[model samples]
Target: MDSARPTPGLHEALAYLDSLRAGDLAPQADVPEDDEDASYDTLDALVDQQDAKPTLRPSPDEALTAIAIMRLCHAAESAGPDLLCPRPGLLSLLFVSSHEDRNRVARRHPDLWRRLSLPFPALMIEDPLGRVGAAKDFHARLAGRLLSGNGVLAIVSGMAQLPPELETLVTARATLPPITRRMLALILEYLHPGHDVDLPISENQLGKLAPVALAPVLAAETLDTALTQLRRLEDVARSPNGGPGLDDVYGQPEAVDALRQVVSDLDAWRAGTLPWREVTKSFLLTGPPGTGKTMLAEALARSAGITLVKTSYSDVQKAGHQGDALKALNAAAEQAKTGSPSVFFIDEIDSFYNRNQSSNGYILGMVNGLLTLIDALSATEGVVLVAATNDRARVDPAIVRPGRFDRHIRVGRPIRSGITAMLSAAVADVIPGPDLDRVSEQLVGLSGAEVTALLREARTAARKAGRDLALEDLQAAADRVQPQLGDALMRRIALHEAAHVVAGHAVGLPAATLARISPRGGEVVRPHLNAMTARDIKGMIAAVLAGREAEDIFFGDVTSGAGAGSNSDLAQATSLGIRAECAFAFGPSLSWISPDTPPTLLPTEVRNRVEARLQAGQEEARKIIVQHRGAVERIAAALLEHRELDGAALAGLLDGVEVQADGAVQHVGGHDA
Candidate 1:
């Protein structure tokens, strides 16, 4: 056999077995004790009990392996006295318990067991465990039985460790034709009471869906059972405070619009005005942590007057195996479908797959199963599949494709006005005065959830001091609960943002606003320039670099605050600097270069010129700060006090301070020379 071809099936099965036996799961999960009573009735009763309680069962892989082994045994029986691969008799049952379980099974079905082993070979493998010599002898006998096509074997063990010869047998069996759909259906019929119920498994879907051995636990006499468990249909009517609606979701207009669009699509589909194919059901929500994605999802469902089916990674993992997880997913889909116009949500969808990397068998199975469930859900009208992730780039690309998760919506960080609104809504008892606006301004880049949490913490702080919610309480809590970049780091960040404001004023950059700087980071918002002259680009680059230059001038050394690489102001500055030099031919030579031209493609002299341009921009910013050192100090002082200042406020402060080259101070009438 070629060494290169991947045997993913074999590896997956092996991984599944290993997972069942790993860590705390081994003793507590799949293993049965050796001293258990030898009664098939007890074992059968236990199986029935487990079937009814899905939470207390082994993974679906065990049942899948058992079925595969049984199919292989049947194949050997049909081969009729000439099987190349080693095979057990017509009734070789791998019980995955102890020798006692095998004996009990034989006792339970005495007639069939006796007939199958009428002419029993000298030593058929009975127990999964025996002496090394006994195991060797059993394999030899098993080979002879396969040659003669007459014998019976039973393998029962709690240990997932397969004997070496048995492992080989399983590998060989993988080459055989898979079990037929008729055979699978028969197995399902024998296992459960309902004959008309739909199973999630099929030949086309076998790779995706696992046959859930514990599915009976979720079975409902009516579809409402599944709907009730997974989809909370009654939540719409049970809302408190004048009932929950879309208004509960704050700072996510785009997400709200998208959800409203989902409701519209559902309405259109139900009215037969929209084609089934045109129905937009699935959506992906992307944002940073604490952006109110979950609240948005719940509010969407609540506002639509429908149920919300919510599931998570931990919930699926608790299902124990592929089959059980698939069953859980199927159950959710079924419930969502049954509860028409419902929202089916998968929180932290990025957790389901390894991005651009090979995932283990369980994750692969989960990804495939979820994809299948999402596809199957299309037939069910008014069921919108919503998945949220903090990092969309970390999710599997296949999941977010057009037909799977058709729409992608973002829940962004809350702005000042949004934060103010959130604060106002959060505070009911105590009144916020002028400092409310100041606090809101300071919370520039916080998420909606974070804003709420900040207020909650503030209230708690105020209550501890036996006082009403005060501005000082809010300020202290904001500082305490905010993500800390350290006090020294905050000083550095303040200087950095202050430099941008001063540079923007000095260099005539348009509409530049210095937003708040928390311990986490800060932002400088500027109006989008429809077009940029070479001077404007250079000025912007200078403003971007002003932070680093300020640190160098004041602190004598710059931290990574300005240039922590990707997505940083320095990174943006460098990118724009390169574009100005190469792409736009804005360099001294005035020669048009390809926009895609890389820095490495530039002539050595041109590269030097690009570096010179960036340095000059940096020097220009330093000169402005030097000329307006008094203004710089004033702006930085005000920023430290308020945590933020708009472009207009900054311009006002700078306009009031004037510095001559001779260091004489005078008041100026207008902002920026």
Candidate 2:
């Protein structure tokens, strides 16, 4: 062989020499006589003895040396004479992990491993756990100790669990030193040939290791296609129609209108010479789950003819580290910026503002970082920032305060007519039976998403049983989709709501148009009158208490159903009673009191007086139920049979007796008239 060529035997000999010095070589029992001139002869005799003992299983150290030699030979053979020469004088110290997968891969495809490991002195590390802190410390110490060289210092492990500090160094951002950046760039080039050696190394490790990491990047014609194939890679999904346009959204005309107005303003701002600040681009959408808040965000973007960048709590958390999360957030914003006239929607805004989250450094840093990003996005012109949360109260006030999120729109559950429209829209494709109205009536309290979910379930059932979507299918789906409030609980709920309806009618309050007792909950959709006198308020309070009172009368005890926390009927009644006592001064007290007036300063007798009023209301409610026992029983029986009753049907059951606003009952005809 030419002296210029590094022969495999010479490479192996050098490897064995290094291993011998490092104590990785196996011990020999035969010792040659002490003589400096005969040392080569002794080494040859030791090699012959090892060859004779080839049956011996290799030790960890021996196996490692063999792996290195195999990689060298495979690299030479595969690359031929054009082997990519290592940058002259560069000593890329790679911290090779003895992780099981890493070892297995190195052994199985030594050639591939060698090609990737080129130009780096692979140092086998015993750390299998791949702790980021330890890795960072190791990298920092090694970089300092080995900075006299010109090559890359790498920690090669199969595990992709990188800490934020190391990630920053890899990206060449944050506080990473210039020398470290140069070293990282060389490593990156080793991994990807033709990568710019001079350009700054800002590429994240996750992206660089995409081909070998747990999840690899998949190229596709469109983002939607990629998402369809690899759901894990998707962050923002293209809306079917700019994310279910207002027409596609089931309900909440008020919210849709507000979004439309904002879009119109955005258009004017974009077209005319008006200041960008004049346009309303940020909104806080508060709603319960399944209420289409996310859909609305997409719709707003679509309505404005803009792209939607949708990110969520789970997405950010999936990124693993604070640096990774910030990268994701920055990528989302950058995508929106590049695709101008875009909407950046952050779903579950409360996740970032949750006080309940642990004060762990990572979580706090992530939330603060996200807040800064949101504020920055608000300053941008073309991107509208719409964030959604199930409850606005859960989010920190600072996040939703003026200037950050200036507009607030509530996407509440669909009311009666809204439910009708939603059900109609959902079933537009199916041929329904005459009982569509019945289905709509039964599905009063469902959200737009719930409505669609039920329709999908019902459609599936209908198709499976070889039938078109029908009322029976819808009802069956409801029974399956809705929570199964046991027969006993459902009966109690029916009686409770029926009692409220009866008490309302008896006390000159309008009866509910539709009354339901579902597994999820119960509701009596009574007439929504704005103005109320003290008597009307008292009647309302009585109606609220009648549910519990009815349970008490029938079962001798009340369920927690009546004592729901905070926002329950009991709470509402108490609030109204207190308001009447203080704010409205409709109580027995002669003096009018402001709502802000301290209750402690109020005469101590006011509390007693308020309790008395509530007690009287309950008593009045009980008396009405007792007087109209037959009507109450009839309504309850009808409710148990039908699960719900329309106003017209309920009116016929009560013989046309209708409550008037003037606290009087009048005999009326059919409810339709």
Candidate 3:
């Protein structure tokens, strides 16, 4: 209703008007009247002659004037139509239409319209389903005639399906210049829906959006600025290598060397000065659990002044499609290329390279994808790959070849000195004494993780009681924990062990540590001899099993506790003795082909050989037991009385009670004498 309200097609109509005015050189034109006007007036008069005439009639001039007046009134009541005008050397508007009569001003200005170029330029028409077939035909005809130079033909439509020719034109390189920067910004905004336009787009953010486009831009930057920013981020992430140096990592000097080498290579590779002819871009860290593989990887990345992208196989496998998984991996790799050095850590890499026959092809495909990605990444500068695995043997051999993972570092259990230092560092606040030393000595074969668990237990015990951790707490914790081998097993183990010691002594092999059986921890049979012939080892094993078998044969039934025999004890003894004879080449009979070198021993053969040797040792062991039954009984009785006895107590009980080979005993000590 408002005259000031611009019609929907105002811009197009105005553009048309401007184009018409520019082309016409003539100035003005007056309104023309003729016989048609007179007829229209006459018809109007006739119609007025009778209010209800059989036929309606009006004077021609009057009728025409009335129609003109109605049109003018309608035009005045509604917002006037927009004028489409073209400006020379600028954009133009073509079509202008609206529902209002006021918008049809062009009909009154026929002369003006005739001179105007009708096909508009830089105007978009919504043509869903290409229904504007005639409109398009009209534009093509006009374009062939009056349209000059390069002009934008914008089409707005809900349906994006365009003719092949139009699509080709829209996407052509030459068409790019006519596309206004504003249009480009709009297209980008539309494509990336919901992205805040005003937010700062950093290298990190750009890398997230389209890493393919952003990675090269970042890589071209100066190294110092890139490294500094990355280091700052690392600090924020609280990464271990956030600081200037690598002094925080404990023990593992060899592992430290390997890490240093990796960092050095990564730096050189980034700087385009690597020395190795074919150095692997990736390193594999394999070891027992909790040996700091993950921590070391992070620290290595941090030290190189790179962002670390850690991913597990489980994360990739969850993506469903192999392509999707690879895309994720590649995206992560690209993200790390943000003008800085980056480490891409693939943890539990064995999962991706599982060599199990039952993996059903999925693993192979994953491995192939990873291999391709790794190869592509290796050729790239400023990116380092570090993979870790607990079971290195389970990984496919192809993944561990020379160039893929050139550096293989093994992290084993901590030795005695390492353990001691670890304890000193971890438990410095806790008071330690002879008990701690003794406990440490007993924990020789434990892995680093196990030792840490022990330490944690000790600390927890002390904390629960609201006191400083003491040696007693550690000792008590140790006592409560049983060894992998049980006590009854250990006694059979000890007698079996004592057999080894006795045989070793008889065979001129050095005696093992005094064979004292105790339930405190399993029978710890430490051979005093550093080395022995295969024959001597076999004799010792035979003796050990002989002791257990002798007790079984002589006593008819073995005891259940420590100092007797059980199924577990028999199994251990017999197995070891067989290994000594059949596997160790310690059997009495020697052949050109050593038993140790057998391709494979059938289970039946192994069982028969072990049984035969065990029976012989049992017979010999029974004779010895019979000769010293009194001394043996005395020791067993004393052990029952005290419920615990050291090596000295057992030795004292046997002192001066001489049992000769003739089975005669003479007491030479106080009570027995």
**Segments in model 3 whose C-alpha atoms lie over 4 Å from true places:** 1-251, 264-281, 302-305, 335-340, 353-359, 429-437, 480-673
TM-score of 3: 0.40
On TM-score, the leading prediction is 1
Candidates in order, TM-scores: namely 0.45, 0.44, 0.40
Tens digits of per-residue lDDT, candidate 2, 611-638, equal 7778988997788777777787788888
379-452 per-residue lDDT for model 1 (tens digits): 44456788889866457878877778777776667656667767777663465546677677667678887777
What's the number of clashes in each of the models? 2, 0, 37
The per-residue C-alpha lDDT of model 3 at residue 75 equals 30
In model 1, the clashing pairs are 96-157, 97-157
Q: What lDDT is reached at residue 664 by model 1? A: 13
lDDT measured at residue 28 in model 1 versus the true structure, 0 to 100: 19
- Each model's RMSD to truth, in Å? 18.2, 19.1, 27.0
| Candidate with more favorable, higher TM-score: 2 or 3 | 2
**lDDT at 242, model 3:** 49
* Cα lDDT for residue 620, candidate 1: 82
Worst 10 residues of 1 by lDDT: 664-673
